[model samples]
Target: MIELDGVSFWYRGRPDPVFADVSLSIGEGELVLFAGRTGAGKSTLLGTVNGLVPHFTGGHLEGAVSVAGQRTDEHPPREFAHLVGVVGQDPLAGFVTDTVEEELAYGMEQLGLAPQVMRRRVEETLDLLGIAELRRRPLRTLSGGQQQRVAIGSVLTTHPKVLVLDEPTSALDPTAAEDVLATLARLVHDLGTTVLMAEHRMERVVPFVDRVVHVPGDGGVVDGAPAAVLRTMPIAPPIVQLGKLAGWDPLPLSVRDARRLAGPLRADLPAPAQPEAHAGAEVLTASGVVVTYGQTVAVRAVDLRLRAGEVLAMMGRNGSGKSSLLWAVQGSGPRRSGRVRVAGVDPKELPAAEARAVVGLVPQTASDLLYLETVGAECAAADAESAADPGRCRALLDRIAPGIAAGKHPRDLSEGQRLALVLAIQLTAAPRVMLLDEPTRGLDYTAKAALSGVLRDLARDGHAIVVATHDVEFVATTADRAIVMAEGEIVTDGPAREVLGSSPAFATQVAKILGEPWTTVAEVAAAVDASAGRVR
Candidate 1:
């Protein structure tokens, strides 16, 4: 369905080609996942498939590229829309209508489909994407995941044979991302639609893919089966590492495959390490915290408390008030009621700057703070208020991102490295309380581990950390406690394992699946191992 032959593209005024001598092909009814570290030309390659690279991006291109046997260079975006559908990273940026039904039908209307046909297609897409309940909802009112599903429905209405997505799940929590991916998988398996997608999170996509295409950082093409190509890459998922250590040929790409190959090895493997709990004092407390944005109650009479040296994870579906609660605690949200104290000082009366002085926030888009000319300067500037040691700043920066040069401009670095730089800067403050909003988003497994190490170190040093996120795997691995919220209210709050085990929607997918009263993969794994004499 798609082909690229010796394709090379360079943006105007850019010194070098963003992609060079690239060659790849995607057949009809095949699912291809285009993956690499950010800015490795994954998105740019997808753009070329739909004629965006040479036309929309104002770039010089050489060689031939075609989709559905139509030459991309000869076709405008509008003409190719019938053959290819591209869903971008930011769905909100592409929204052109107010309601979900209208958004889904807009493309069909633009194509001049009959009214009956448009209506039928809209209904089918809404149902196909599991967004029927959201048909009448305003686009702005929908959560990030719902909005993305709507965006996909908008494209699918055209019934294009090939679908291309650029990190559709990057902005979504685990459950939401899974929903979207599940829909796409259904389209590929049941409907026989061709799928090509680029994603930074390999753990989610590795199992679903038949093959992997790696875009080289220095501008080239790397492609092979998911197993063969993943081994040659410097970055890989944990299951991939486990497969390597166990000496499995054509190393398993998913946890299930790894587990199957791990039968004998599991018996000899060391017991999972337990994180030492800090017997420390409370550092923050919120009683009856109610925050409302106009009529929308984001945190409805919620109560929470943080203790020193504890890693607390706040989880829920997208727009379930996770970020809102974090903002309330940070003193940066809309009007907040009830008592909120950081280190026993009420935050409502305290200036945001003062509250932040005691609690540092590692925001979701921390990379936006990177405007400095060089990496070293950005880290030092973030700590301008305190007489922070230069050596300490360098040490922290190197710890999270030893791959990047400190002398290079932050903008010149890849997206993941830029985020790591911001995280390193946030740690320099040494705040007693740290608030992180989806810190693992857009990060690869290696980077995720690096950031986790930093957070673990801080927690060991007596910093109370609260992470508002939808990454359940991350919570299972890192958090000491878990808080569940739904419809802007706390649904469950307790030990991390208990809360996760009790979540029906989330429990089945856990690495260590369990029934009621068991809330974590570790617990289920332990139970199974003990029964099988696999516990070491």
Candidate 2:
């Protein structure tokens, strides 16, 4: 239903095209995944389907692109709205209405559908994406994951022939992501809708995708079955990487397949070494933390503590108070009742600038912290505000996410690039306590690895870090401690491996295939190497 004939695209003043000579086709009812490193033109490719590339984005296009018999070049994005439903990475930027129900119905209303038809589709979409409970909630009040679901439901209600989503499940928790992906699978199988998605978290989508399209950042595209394409792809899901490491032929794409071939390898591997405990002094303490939005209690009275050199991961279902707790602790969001003390000072009583020095926060919407035009300006401003070295912020940006142009506008950056910029700005402050909410939303595995290393180094440098996230793989690799929250309360707190391995919903692919104490592929690979060394 979708075809690209020798398509080459480039931005103004750039000599090299983002992608070149990309001739591809997607059969009707096919669920195709676009896999690549961050800023490797995955999102740019998705935009071409809905005519947002050359038309709205002001880029040069060569060759023809058509979807469902409509040429994107001939028609504008709005004209193809009936044929394509596109969801960008940042959902909040696309929202036009206040409440969940209204946003879901807005697309249909624009299509001039009958009131009854719009209402029926709205209800069906709400149920399909599992957002029926959020129908009455205001859009601003919902969590990032909730907003992501609402954004997808709004597009799904239109019932377009082709659905194009960029990082659809990036903000969702594990359970919610499965629900959304399962719903997409149903659409492909039962309703014959075509889905073209770009996601960094490949583990969740690899099993469900009918085909894989790998973009290798060299202005080329590789397309084939999952196993065929993953063999040479630089980045891969944990299951695929494990299969490769174990020398399993026809690399497994799912946990079930990996487990079937893991018996001998599991036997050969030694138990993973236990993580060392953090013995640093207490840096922050909070008690009776309560955050409320009128009748809604986002964060119940809770007590928490953080040491000087610890990385704590706060995890839970969407809208389960992770973000609320983070915001309250940072003294930015509503805290009806709470006392947060950092370095013997109450941040809530300090000015915003002073509070940031005491406790820095990189919010879920990382772009909110970036207002400067160019990346260089933002870094310069961050350095000036923090009274740091002139080039400190830029150096941090390079360390976190390399290759970002200093002159590029922050608004024009990819989601992952923007997130990295915000992180660099926050780190320049050198706050004693750092809090990040969903920091890995758009980062590729490589970028995430860089971030994980940065966090580890910061912890070693006597910085206390708390990350509120849904990326279980990230938590497994980065966090030293894990705290599971539910309905405005902390329900479980323990070592990261203990907490992640114990929960089936949050376990990593390696842990599932190789069993407990093996939550990351790196650790497993290390154990395998150790066993081999001993035998030699």
Specify the highest-TM-score model's number: 2
**Candidate 2, residues 264-336: lDDT per residue as tens digits?**
9888887888888989999999999999999999888999999998999999999999988988888878899
The positional error of residue 91 in candidate 2, measured at the CA in angstroms, is 0.9
The deviation in Å at residue 271 for candidate 1 is 4.1
lDDT for 509 (candidate 2): 88
Residue 364 lDDT, candidate 1, scale 0-100 = 66
Model 1 agreement with the true structure over 351-422: per-residue lDDT tens digits: 766765688787765766677798878867766743577666667767766756667777655556676777
- The root-mean-square deviation over C-alpha atoms between each candidate and the true structure, in angstroms, is 4.3, 1.1
Model 2 Cα displacement at 233 (Å)?
A: 1.2
Best lDDT among the predictions, by candidate number: 2
User: What residue pairs clash in candidate 2, if any at all?
Assistant: none
